[model samples]
Target: MANNLQIASAAYIVMHLLTKKKQSSIKKRRWWTTQIFRSRQLYNGTSMIRDLNFHTDSGQFENFARMSQEDFEHLVSLLTPIIAKQTTHFREPIPVNERLAVTLRFLATGESYTSLQYVFKISKQCISLIVPEVCQSLIEVLKEYVKVIINTFINNSK
Candidate 1:
């Protein structure tokens, strides 16, 4: 009888522990959990891309991004169709222009995703995903331009 009681008690303890472990593993999902992510719009006005003032200061913009404002805008336009995302009920998607700017800034400065997170007011995880996707899109969109350039060079050589 004592052994039976001990077995029951051990089983109960095991069950209780399992239940507690399951509860702890289940995390709650919330929209915009961090203050920094929520303040992205407020920081946008003072962001590197905007504060550089593409029209008024092309030299500064070019220096910062390693590309002129026109080239930046042209790249944005070319990649927009491929990279654009739809806004959902939960939140608006990050704009294509912002994604391109982030990728270009990363390429130009070789800054880590963590450093860019604070500058762009975006999460490092999001920036990590954005950079690769934008780079692939750039390669895809620029292929035609590359082909044209190669063809022109060949014709001139001949």
Candidate 2:
């Protein structure tokens, strides 16, 4: 048992060493290590930190309700324009990659909050803040685009 555990730990350390250079240079190594440690603590024995990415607290993300794909795309379109404006105004909002990941997760699975935390590698609190803001932005700015689609749909239904 001890030998197997040692081998696994050695393998992980090797992988982490290789990946770290490609990932980011650690300026404050201690701080980054400490932060990572604390974040892992949030799992409270639930998360399994393996060789590569840790799958922590994965959960099902069934939509409480359902909607058509058109409705979903329209929602995304509605927010895209507004997101540009709002994101620009902030000195530095969440990074674009993070934003894209969040948006894609919502579109893909319509996941609940906890599943999102693990999948996106973000805190549940952060997800709480971002998802709603994006949703509102989508609704407000895509008025013309949505209107055109809605009008076309109405005509087709006739």
Candidate 3:
């Protein structure tokens, strides 16, 4: 899970989109599902409510969404040229365009890998491999943008 204060601006934007998803999902969920969640809780009343692990929204929601849609579009535009160009050797370069969309769908829905296999018409293992590979590649690819933000934050504090 990402620390709220430390999330890159891009990640924060993604989290906001996630919040809207979470609310809709909760509303559509069956009553039995909510009961299961309630039973799992060890609660203290009066603002001490706690839920396990990261959901679509976490501390990021404590702040209202401040970034505008234009700003978000600008960010994605900045990231739009995401083609990887390496050719040391390859019988097959990953067809990243299709892979990225499928992985994003999985992340947004939290759908199980088995479910994805049927949707993607690939084996479960391939789906599993593509997801992590996408994650690792995104981390590396976004390092410059994310690191600049992080480093500026660190320098500002001192």
Candidate 4:
């Protein structure tokens, strides 16, 4: 009876080892799953702008946005409070700098929604939602600045 008990214990150990080996050897094709694919989707906000050196490369940045970096900063500062209030704490708020850059790119280049998505690594739905919101915010924030610039331009032309 002792030998029988020892044999049963050895068989159980062997079976457990085999099960672990099989589990480890099996290649999981988890990369093909929707969850994995979704996780791999690119997200570009503040870092994208920084990586592209929009702050440092004044010439390229101005060419892309049709506005100087100083003006861009001013616009972002003006719009920050409004956009900040609109954003909730539920999810990460896209930075005011990114929103302003994306809006300026769209307005300056007349780029399509699809193109903007590729450029910004943002979803089409989000881009569509953001563009209008930023535009409206810009109108509200820059109204006074626009008036001053227009007045200066008219006076200079005289």
- Candidate 4 TM-score over all chains jointly: 0.59
lDDT (CA) per prediction: 0.85, 0.54, 0.51, 0.75
| Residues 87-141, model 4: lDDT tens digits | 5765456678878888888888789888887666666677798899999988887
Q: State the weakest 10-residue window (summed lDDT) of model 4.
A: 32-41
lDDT tens string, model 1, 18-37? 99999999988776448888
Candidate 3 local Cα displacement, residue 106, angstroms = 1.6
Clashing pairs in 4: none
* lDDT of candidate 2 at residue 31, scale 0 to 100: 52
Better of 2 and 3 by lDDT: 2
Error of 2 at 57 (Å): 31
Query: Model 3: how far is 24 from its true place, Å?
Result: 53
The model with the greater TM-score, 2 or 4, is 4
Candidate 2 lDDT over 21-82, as tens digits, reads 86776565545233533564444212322211222222222131133334544554645545
Displacement of residue 111 (Cα, Å) in model 2 is 1.2
TM-score of every candidate relative to the true structure: 0.74, 0.37, 0.36, 0.59
Order the candidates by lDDT, highest first — what do you get? Answer: 1, 4, 2, 3
Better of 1 and 4 by TM-score: 1
CA lDDT, candidate 3, residue 46: 10
**lDDT of model 3, residue 93:** 35
Comparing candidate 3 with candidate 4, which one achieves the higher lDDT? 4
Better of 1 and 2 by TM-score: 1
Give stretches of model 3 more than 4 Å off. Answer: 1-94, 147-158
lDDT of 3 by residue, 20-112 (tens): 889877755345233322432233111121221113345431222233334423433443456333445522333443355446657767889
